[model samples]
Target: MEAYLAWVAIDLVIPNPMNPRRDHSIESEQMQEILRSKGWAEAITCYRKGQYYIILSGHRRWHAAKKMNEKEVPVYIVQAPENNAEELDRLGSIQGGQVDWTPYEWAKYTYDIWKNSGKASYSQLANKLGISQSLVGSRIRVYKFYPRIEIEDKLSNGMYSLSMLDYILKWIKRVEKHHFELYQSMGEELIRKQMLKKYENRCFNSKIAIDNIFVTSACSKDILEFLTDINKKLQDCQFELELLKVDNEVDVTQNKLNVKMIIDEIRLIECRTKNEAGNLKEELNKLLKEIELKENQLFDMVEN
Candidate 1:
């Protein structure tokens, strides 16, 4: 079949069942807003199939059009893919840059392709998909482990994250190793559920905070060192900013002095003249105490 563009009735185009995307509510609503304001600009990509056309991409746009009671919409009709794998590849390639696939969504399509292609090698599949083999393996693992609809929905909805999944896997390994007694007592399924619940409740709104808390819970010394490095860099930036305010020429001559030597001199002067050093010391002390408390509490939670 020859590929061509045409205007089709809104109802004639159907969403692909094999498309990895499960949730379109958010994207569709955003597109609906765009349509109302600027009107439709991009054509839906689809392929001829029987009396109706199956969408290859632009499922969200089609949804948005229907929601707004659009009568007809522009569509680019392409030749039907020879196989499911080809169709999935086309969809992934087309949508790759526009929007990221959710962790589970990516897993779903990757698993489907692997399965449908007679269980192809991870290396071959990864090469074809332009991703690492380890990534392909991990996605397949995620798909298998979280096959339950409810769990997949939570991951798709962004209630949890891909990093959280990695954390959960690490926690499981630790439970199986150092915490063997707890693992035996709780069993695998319950341990998984409990960990999910624990992280879900503790998950923060910000990625940085989530990483901080997770890292702190796992190893406080690392997070403390990370914070210390960040603080030192912040102080350096502040010093540079102050110098820029006083005279731009200070920047030109900054390389002449050892930056560390300059910072130490400034710190010594500030320590002599200001109470800010005392406050920072107190804050660091408080943070240390809080971290110790959290470590103890986390250990207790894991054991109980």
Candidate 2:
């Protein structure tokens, strides 16, 4: 349908809300503040084909205008579909030209609309709102995992970040599916301790590698801290492993030494060990060969 803009009088009895999209809490507060601070009122637009439909801008403003019991608010009327499906699809694409929302805000907004519409693609929804598809997907995933109470509290308090929500969702999923039994059996304290222990070990290993590569003024301090933390973790893991160890008599000292040597060789940059380094060495060699093949193909193309 051809789109045209027109102003419509504010009606209290107008049953259809401006947008079906909820999480309007943020928008409502923002619009109200803007209007009160500016000491001005503005026109809201509605799309009309047969019955009047609000479109484009002033969703929050329209609500505020209603609350204030204002008469004949100016509106830019545009032509839009009257049917539910078409109207929603159009809403998904339509830019209200309102203030730019943050990633979290946009995620929540887009997620609701997408959930309701069940027709908008991730790319289409994100593109319409000028956000990344991954972000849209991540938000939807977060919404799926997080309890409504937590999300509402976070969003309301403005303590929410998309990254934080992403992490929380991941943690929730991990706790729910993989660790639920363990979490229940071991209790929250023990689970937390194990998580912290694992994190410390990984951090220690990463830091050791980094320190070996780079030299800096604070390097000593970092290394000392990392070593201290990692040593504690190592002690814990060692104790745990010792508890689980089985009493078996096998002469494997030579084999253990060989494996350690192979691990050392993998850490080296220049050395290439094919036979001596075992499966890890073989995997590395294969990866290097694949990289070389790709490089050769690129070189040939350039030469041509």
Candidate 3:
């Protein structure tokens, strides 16, 4: 591959139509910041076509330069092949550095590579990416999540870690279609929050989690059902608290009645032994004061 650095006009280099990837990539602004701070670490890839140049990769960086009002930007010009389709497909494999492509981006363009090149085998893809077949297979499964655009923004924005993404994709595969669709509609962060709640044990068990997803995830049939479930839980908790309050009131009432009975018996004793009755009445008054304090506490609980 003949390659050389050339400062090309910003307007001359255009995004290739055949490049299968979403251009609403979240990395453009970050790249702009990086270019402003670090001043362009690597040259973008392009090939010449007559007078104009076409970009195979680095669309984000290219757009970032345009935003900065740059007339021309440096690019590594890879010699154009006669058959542009096959060559662009080949070059797509080597586009950008580590963290450039989102999982969805990979799925889209990798599908392009497969289709353009007449559908390569799994081992062929593994060999091309220099990874094991299983990793390639896992990435292919991630393609299924592409239909979920709400997640695309997050996934493209670097919202999830590799291992967490692995677990999420795994969960998507095993979960019921409707539930998974519901989860997809709920936004990525909410699902991530629920996943982390389950991942508190740090096991990342998708199979077991999927089995209990409805209960754990608060899945509901409709708005009425959701509200009904929440209201029912609240009512049950309130009922338990009310039972405790009732028990406390009953104990307090019984103590007050017993104190009354004691006072009556003491009055009768006073008729026979006045001095002993006086000491016993003083002790009974202290006991009655303690019970009154307990009753006040119960009142406070009710008021609150």
**Candidate 2 to truth, TM:** 0.47
**TM values, all candidates:** 0.58, 0.47, 0.49
- For 1-304, candidate 2 gives per-residue lDDT tens digits of 5554444567622423535335444556666778778844555545654555554555667777676667656665666565665555555455334444444445555666676667489998778658788877877876665555545555645555555556534543445454455446556444434433444344323232222122222233332343335344433433434443422213356656876886797677454576555766678889789769978997998999
lDDT for each residue of candidate 1 in 1-304, tens digit (9 for 90 to 100): 7878899998898998998887666567778999889876778889888979898888888888888899999999988889988888788887766756777888888899899888899999999889999788878866776545646768767787755565565546554665465567657776566556656655322333233223323233332232234223323333445555567566636744765675576466545545877886886689679769978997998999
- C-alpha root-mean-square deviation, candidate 1: 18.0
Per-residue lDDT of 70 in model 2: 70
lDDT comparing candidate 3 with the true structure: 0.63
Residue 101 displacement in candidate 2 (angstroms): 4.4
**Model 3: per-residue Cα lDDT over 91-198, one tens digit each:** 566573433666666666656555555667878977876767766665665554435464556665666443455556565444335455655566555554444443
Q: What is the total number of backbone clashes in candidate 2?
A: 8
Worst 10 residues of 2 by lDDT: 209-218
The pairs that clash in candidate 3 are none
* Candidate achieving higher TM-score, 1 or 2: 1
